[model samples]
Target: MLTVILYHVIFVIVVYTDTGPPYNAFPQKLNFYYFSLYVIPSTTCFFIVLLSTIFLVVKVRRNQRWRKGTSTQTAKTNDKEDKLVRTIIAISTIFIICSFPTVSIFITQIIHKQFRYRDPYLGTLLLLMFNIGGVFQAISSSVNIFFYYRMSSRFKKVFASLFACRRSGIQGTKPSD
Candidate 1:
C-alpha cells in the first residue's frame, strides 16, 4: 500500500521535474551527449512501469472474486491461492520500488542547482543501470505468476475450489455440504 503511493508520487515528480524549461534549456545550451542515454532510457522505463503495472494488476482482478468480510492477510492454507496473492503483492512491490530511482534521478536534475549536471560518463553509467533495473521490473511483472506458484497458499485453495466447482457442475453432481 505504501509502496503504491510512493511510486505514484515519484511518477508525478519525474514527469514535472527535468521536463520543464530549466532542465530542457541546459541540454540545448550545453549539448551534452551523456544526458542522452541516462535521461531518455530512465525516463522511458518510468512510463513503461506505470503502464505495465496498471495492466498487470487490473488483469489479475478482472474476473476474480473478493471474499466479503475477509482480511486479505489471512491465508487460506491452500498454496495456490496464497501464491497468487503473494505474487500480486510481490509484483506490485517490485514495480513500485523499481520505478522510484529513475523518476528520482529526473527529480534530482531538476533540484540540484550547483552541479550543472554531473560527469557525462558517470551520468551515462547511472542512467544505464536505471534503465536496466526498469527492464527487470517489467520482467518481474510479466513473470509474477511463477512466483505466485511458489509462495501463495491462499491462492491454491481458492483456485482448487473454483476448479472443483467447475468440474462438479460439468458432471451434474451435487456440491459437498
Candidate 2:
C-alpha cells in the first residue's frame, strides 16, 4: 500500500542520512533526528491524506452529479454518500491542521539553520510546537469515534451495544431470567 511505501522511504532516508553522533548526544543531531522522525512523517502523511481526500471528494461529487434527480432511493443513497464524504473531509482537514505547526516549525528551522548550533529558545519553541501538534493529532484521531456515533445511526447502535455488553460482562449478569 501507499502507506507502506511511504514509511519505507522515510525510514531509508533517516537511516542513510549522515546525522553524525548518536541521538540526543548532540543538540544539533537531536534536532535533525526530531525533524526526521516527527516533522517529515507528519508533513508527508498530511499531503498524502490531503491529496487522496481531494480525489475522493471529486469522485463522489462527480458521481452525485451523474446520478442527480434519479429516484427517491437514489436520493437517499446520495444523502448517505454525501455524509460519508463530509466525514472523510472533516478528518483529513483536522489532520492537516494538527500537522501544520510541526511541519512549519521544522521547515523554518531548516531554512534558518537554527539547529546547527545550540539555541535554548529555539529548542523551547520547538518543544512547544511539537506538544501542540501532538495534542491536536490525538484529538483528530479520537474525534472520528464521536463522528461515527453521530453521523450513522447504525454506528451508534453498534457502539452502544458494544459498551452494554462490556458492562454486562463486568457485572457478571445474565439479564433477568
Candidate 3:
C-alpha cells in the first residue's frame, strides 16, 4: 500500500505540472492513466468487499445452524460474531452506495471521450454529478467512525474515555479549601 501510494504521488507530480486554472485539461494518455489509477483500485475494492461480505453472511448463517444446540458460552461468542458481521455488512453497503457514483462517472468518462465536452447542458450535468460524487467519497471515507461507535460498545467506551481524558486534562481539579 505504501509503495502504491508513493508511486501515485510520483506519478501525479510528474504528470500534473501545469499550475493553471484549467487543471482538468491533461493530455489524453495522462487522462487515461489518471482515470485508470483511481477507477481500478476503487472498483476492485468494492467487488472484494461485496464478495467477502456475502461469504461472511453465508458462513455465519451456516455456523449458527450448526451451533444451535451449543452452550451459552458458545452462543455468546456467536452473538459477538454476528454483531461483527452485521457491522461489516453495514459498512460494505455504505461503501457500495457511496462509491457507485464516482465509479460510474469514471467509467462513463472513459467510455465516452467527449462526456464533459460534447454538449453544454450535458457537460453541466456531468459537472454536477462529479461534485455529488465528491461528496459521496468524503462521506464514505469519514462515516466509518460513526458506524464503529454506534455498533460496538467497546468502541464507544474507548472513544468516550479518550475524550474524557482530554477534558479532565484541560480542566484540572481545584485545590482543597
Top candidate (TM-score):
3
lDDT of each: 0.60, 0.74, 0.79
Better of 1 and 3 by TM-score: 3
Please identify which of the two predictions, 1 or 2, would achieve the higher TM-score against the true structure: 2
- Alpha-carbon RMSD of each model: 13.8, 4.7, 3.7
* Ranking 2 against 3 by TM-score, winner: 3
- Predicted candidate 2 versus true structure: per-residue lDDT over 1-177, tens digit per residue: 797578767765765565544645566555656666666776777788879999999998987886774534455787899889988887778777877776777678768876433567676776777789778878878887887787787989999999999998989965786
Residue-level lDDT tens digits of model 1 in 57-93: 6665552445423545344433445456556667666
Candidate 1, TM-score vs. the true structure? Answer: 0.38
- Candidate 3 residue-wise lDDT, 32-134, digit = tens: 6666567677777778877888998899888777777564446578778888888988998999899899788877977987776446767888889979989
Ranking by lDDT: 3, 2, 1
- C-alpha lDDT of residue 167 in model 3: 93
Better of 1 and 2 by lDDT: 2
